[model samples]
Each structure stands twice: as C-alpha cells, then as structure tokens.
Target: MPPASLPSPSRPWPIPKLHLRIDDLHHEGVDIFLNVVNPKEALHEAIMASFQWLYTPETVPRTVLQILLVLRPMDGVAYTTGTQSHKEIHFSLDHIKRSVKRARDEIMGVLVHEVVHCYQYNALDTCPGGLVEGIADFVRLHQGYTPPHWKPTGGGKWDTGYERTAYFLDWIESRYGDGTIKELNEWMKDNQYHRRIFKELTGRPVRKLWKMYCSSLGDPITDGFVLVSKLIVKSYKPLYPPTWKGPDPGFL
Candidate 1:
C-alpha cells in the first residue's frame, strides 16, 4: 500500500510519444503480459507515476519528447537511457517470466522505475549512483508497486540504492515534511551534487541524518553528531519508557 500522503498529478506534464516494441511475440512471458495489461496504458501509468511523485508541471522537464519501450529476452532486469529528446527502455522478458505470479505488478513496477530514470535529474551525471536508483524505487514505492517480499531494514550507507535508499528517503520525507524529496530533486536540476544539499533541506548533514536514523531503532552510533531524538517512526511500540507510549500523535 502507498503511504496516504503521497502527492498527485494535479497538472499535466509534457506527454511524450509512448511506443512499445515487443521483440518476442511467442514468448511465454508475452502470454502473461497480454493477459494482465494494455501495454499503452501500462506505459502511460508509469509516466504519470514519475511526474506525479517527483514533479509538479512547473518543475517538470519538457525535453523528453518520446519514450520507446523495447521488450526482449534478456538476463537480470530492465534499464533506460537515451538522449535528451528521446528515451529507450529495455525490459527483460526473462525477468517477467520469473516473476509470473505477480507479473502485472512487477512489470509496472519495473516500468515505473525505468521511466523515472528517463526524466529524473542526474546532477549532471555526478549524483551518487545509489541516490539515482533510490529515487527510481521511491517512485515505485509511492506507486503502490512495492513487492510483498520487500522489507524495510538498514544495512549499508544511506545511499545503498534500490529499496534500502527508497525506505530511508520515505522516512526522511515523513520526518521532516512532505515534498522533501521533491525539493532535493529540484536542487539537482541545474547544478552538480554536493552532500550539503541534505543539510540545506533538513537542517542536518546527510551523515548526521543517517546516524540519527540508525540510532532510532536502538542501534548505537560511534560517531557523535548533533542528534535529534524527536524523529521516531512512532509505529514501533516500546515495552518501557512511559513517555513513548501512545498511538502515533503525528499520524493522528
């Protein structure tokens, strides 16, 4: 389920020419694909998911004039890349076949993630690769397409990529305010990336925020940074600490 507070596509973004190229019509994955969704609608949905979550029409890039989805038999998953005016998405039929039980969700999820890459600012290609992937998954997560097997857990750095970074971003968005990620993305529009962007947005540096995030779940941090204990998930109940006992006052 998507968090209730996700932003919407209140205005129209530039609608690119959406096209699909199915490399194998006889593939088993094609059978499931045709059974589940209309290709045009699926592609359009992914586009809308990208615009709605990451931008308002005013901030959206109008340079993307077309998106071509190429579905072929390949290993692993999908990827997207192209010039400023045209984008190409290469989706794997093999991956779709493997995720057969949840084909519709998985395909749309991958499409959403890829489409995000086509439109998202890359800090002129200097942005951390993990943040790039995380922004993609963040759009996927907000689209209500997160797989059932996905879990929210901390493991490497804040920019660990994929769902790890997506969850961390969602937590930050929930903690500081809505559209926190939106502002972060906008800052990357015309300039190269710097770690200071996080501090500018949240009044704390990225490292400090990540440490506070780690410490929230009873993890100890060796790096003594200025900590803010006020930002809790509020969903995890404690056995003691009477002051912490309550239904989420923030959510209420």
Candidate 2:
C-alpha cells in the first residue's frame, strides 16, 4: 500500500448560519464597508483564521452554529454577544468610516479578533481579561493584519493586553516553540487561568519573561539590568502566513 497523504488542513471549519444587517443603508460607512468586503466571505475568512491558529482540524469547535453581524452606528468599535452556539458581532459603522483609508484591513482585523472569541476556550471565564484580549490580538497579528500604528514595544505589566501583550506573546512563541501560543490556548481549555501557566510553558514566570521582553525592547526593566534583545525577527508569522483585541471588540 502506498503511504496515505496527510489530511489537508484547508478543509473548511464548520461555519455557522452567517447573517449580516446594515442598520443604515444610506450611511457612507456602509458603502465603504461593502466596498471593502463581502460579509459572508469576510466572516468566513475570520473563522478560518481562528480555526487555523487555535485548533487542529480534529479539535475545531463545533459549538458555534450561528453568527450574525450587525453593522450600525455605535460608540467605540465592535462587540460580540450570544449563547455558546450562536454569536452576534456588532460593528461600529462610524469606526468603519474613520478607517476608510484602510477599511479593508481594519474591518478584517476586527472580524478576526471577534471571531476568535466565538471559538477560543476562556478557561471557563477564569482567564484574565488582558490575557483573553492578548490572545485575540495575537491571532490578528499572526494573520498579517497588524495595524500600522501597532508597535512591538513592551511595558505596563505582561498581560496589559492588546498589541503590547500580543507582541510579548509573539516573542515567547519565537523564542520557545512554534505552537507556544496554541499550547497556551489548549492549556486553558480545561484548566483555570493561572499565572503559572507561563512558567509551565516557558520554564520562567511571566514577570521574568516580561522583564526580559522589556529590556530587550530598550525599555527599563525593574530588575536593574538591561539585556539586549537578540533582535528576533517580528516573525509571529504562522506556519502558513495569513492571517484582535479580545472577545469583546471594545477597541478596534
């Protein structure tokens, strides 16, 4: 018998009943958003990004059975709400308009971030909010949709969240192993969130990791030593280059 080929990972994850609603068709933001992306495809791509990062094909989440996106005039950016099997993503049309200069990337980035919440295990809600947000953005960063404004500089406690914590995790992924973040997510599946998960993953406490990461970035470390960064390429690049703030899209 010939060696069987490995299963292709490109097999699509189970997508829910996808739906889209535009609160105001006349809104210029809606026009810009439509011009930038088709809703079904955008949502589908976001789903794929989440699945690719957080699960193997065999382990993909089957809980999400519906995803409805509401594009409306709202303060802040976006947010997701729903039961385990169904979720609604509310996007801010005003923010879309503001991001018209790079609407496609911004819209897609936010979608990917929110979608991760739909699927990621949250340590039964015991995970710190910052870690939750960091994982979301980490997925976004891996997807190659990092905003131009994002800087990799480290500061303000390790789990500070958003791009800052995402970058810190990126450093860990590069220095430790390829699936370090994936392992982090999987570890959270059945276990409660604990800071020691960092040590378990990297053999060092997160504080020490953050300290090293800060000093690597030319930022002051609390330990009174400035270790030079090896200048590791910002290659949070995934096994397959593709490609969030949190489950809640409070900030785009």
Candidate 3:
C-alpha cells in the first residue's frame, strides 16, 4: 500500500474504508457520542485535517488502505497503531464520557492526533516517542481543534510532548515559514531523527532556536521578525514565490 496523497480542497482525500467498533454499547459515552458526531464524517474530517496540514497533494502518502476506529471501554485516552498498510485507533469510551461537555472537540482532537500517527514519518521508527507524540499534537494544533484549556506559553522543554511541543513547532514554522515542519518531516523520511535538521531547514540548530523561542516569549514578533525577514530575503523567487508572514491567501 502506498501512502495517501497530499491534501487539496479541490480534491477531497480518498478516505479509505472506515470502520467503527464500539465495545460497550451501553456505556454513557456511547449515548453522548451518538448525540454528537457521525462516525463516517468524523473520520473523514479527521483524515482530511491530517492531510491538509501535514501533506500537500504531491507529497501525501497513499499507503494506508484502511483505518479502523475502535471505541471501547479502556484506560487512559486513545492511541493508534498498526502495520504500514493498515491502522487501528483505540479510544476509551470512559475518557469520552469524561469529556462529555467538550465531546466534539475532544473526540476530534484525539482523532486528528491518532490519524497523524498513521501517516507521519518516524525516522524509520527511531524518533523520540515524545517527539512523535508532539508531532501528532502539532498536527492537531494546526487543525484548529485545540482544547480551550490549551495555553501556548509554559516554561517547559521544547520537546515536552503534546501541546508544549506543538506550540514550539508552531513558533518554529512561524519563524522559519510555512511547511518548515513538513520539510522537517520529509527530511526524516529516509534519515534518522537529528537535531541538525533544524539547522538544515532554518540555518539555526535546535538548541539555539529553542533558546531564541523561549526568550521571545515576551515579544515573539520581534524575535521571529528577524528570521522571517531573512527567509523572505533568501528564499525569494517568482512563480514559486518567497515565504510570507502568516498564511498568504493573496497567493491563492
């Protein structure tokens, strides 16, 4: 199975065979879930968000032949795992019940994170688990599915998983330019995970970049301004064009 294609609104992702298996039909989570999301569209939307944020049509992987989402009575939250050609997402119904007030947000957030694991590169499966989880949440962060509880700046290690790393990556892309993370991901496609990829992509290594990121907490635009300006200058081109501050719908 080849990887899925990169995303495009003109061509919706070819959603693979989607199957939902609910372990405890009587669980209160089931009631709440049925009250909210439709399994078909929910999974489709999750897949699209992953494709949209991480992969472009030319680069999206087409190998995932199927995605089976299992909503069962289990511990913790949710996780995705399977062979390269198939993926399974095991979500805890109890956790779903606990998130009843924000069921839609919580469900979609977890789904997006899990779906990313299905398609994202893992440096031949040697990438740090925290970084892997962080990448998943990074995609989730970009999907506009952030939980209301998520706060951007908290003094934590840059790779401190989940939203912390997601926000760090968000800042990295904002500083380096859009698709910088995608380039980082692509770099890992055939190579081992290396901190040097940061330098390769942005001309600054990860440590220095992280330090600059943290110091910029008080004034991000000022800190990011320099790198953004440099990218605009060095990366300029016609037809292809140079990077811009934030999304340039103008290009479209």
Best of the candidates, lDDT: 2
Badly placed stretches (over 4 Å) of model 3 are 1-12, 219-252
- What are the Cα lDDT values of the candidates? 0.79, 0.81, 0.74
Clashing pairs in 2: 143-243
lDDT head-to-head 1 vs 3, winner:
1
Task: Compute the lDDT for candidate 3.
Answer: 0.74
* Predicted model with the maximum TM-score: 2
**Of models 2 and 3, which has the larger TM-score?**
2
Model 2 spans > 4 angstroms off: 1-6, 9-12, 223-252
Prediction 2 global C-alpha lDDT: 0.81
Q: Per-candidate TM vs. native?
A: 0.84, 0.85, 0.81
Once fitted onto the true fold, the runs of candidate 1 whose alpha carbons sit more than 4 angstroms away are 1-11, 221-252
Candidate 1 has its poorest 10 consecutive residues by lDDT at 237-246
The order of the candidates by TM-score, greatest first, is 2, 1, 3
lDDT of 1: 0.79
Q: How far is candidate 1 from the true structure (C-alpha RMSD, Å)?
A: 9.5
